[model samples]
Target: WYRQAPGGSLQWVSFISTDSSVKKSEPAMEGRALVSRDNSRSESSLSLRALGPRDSARYFCA
Candidate 1:
């Protein structure tokens, strides 16, 4: 997962795998983001906590 602010380069958020392991790429996201996956459906999700104005950005998953 990644986030891109206006005019800013893409910023790494977290890494998730089918094994259900998550690696945070940014310290700011530690404890503030949650990553989960459902292998049965081949779907994944990202949850953000306590959002604020600064949190506004374009989010992407690859």
Candidate 2:
């Protein structure tokens, strides 16, 4: 969901979401955006990144 590029215009990167609840009929966004959602309480703690590394990326949720 992120690129290693530093402030350079790049190609369109295909995004994939593992959450079945995350359904998008149509959506478009620009720039760096931190997305968070509490879809299910049972899913309190799970893998944050399935396609890439969670690493030192700073993220937060309510």
Q: Quick one: best lDDT, which candidate? A: 1
lDDT of 2 by residue, 1-62 (tens): 43323444342222324464442211222223323335466332223333344233432221
TM-score of each: 0.86, 0.19
**Model 1 TM-score, all chains together:** 0.86
Full-model lDDT for every candidate: 0.84, 0.33
Shift of residue 55 alpha carbon in model 1, Å? 1.0
lDDT of 1 by residue, 1-62 (tens): 99998888999988887688645657888888888888889898899998988778999988
Runs in model 1 deviating more than 4 A are none
lDDT of 2 at 24: 27
- Candidate 1 lDDT at 28 equals 86
Q: List the residue pairs that clash in candidate 1.
A: none
**Best TM-score among the predictions, by candidate number:** 1
lDDT value for candidate 2? 0.33
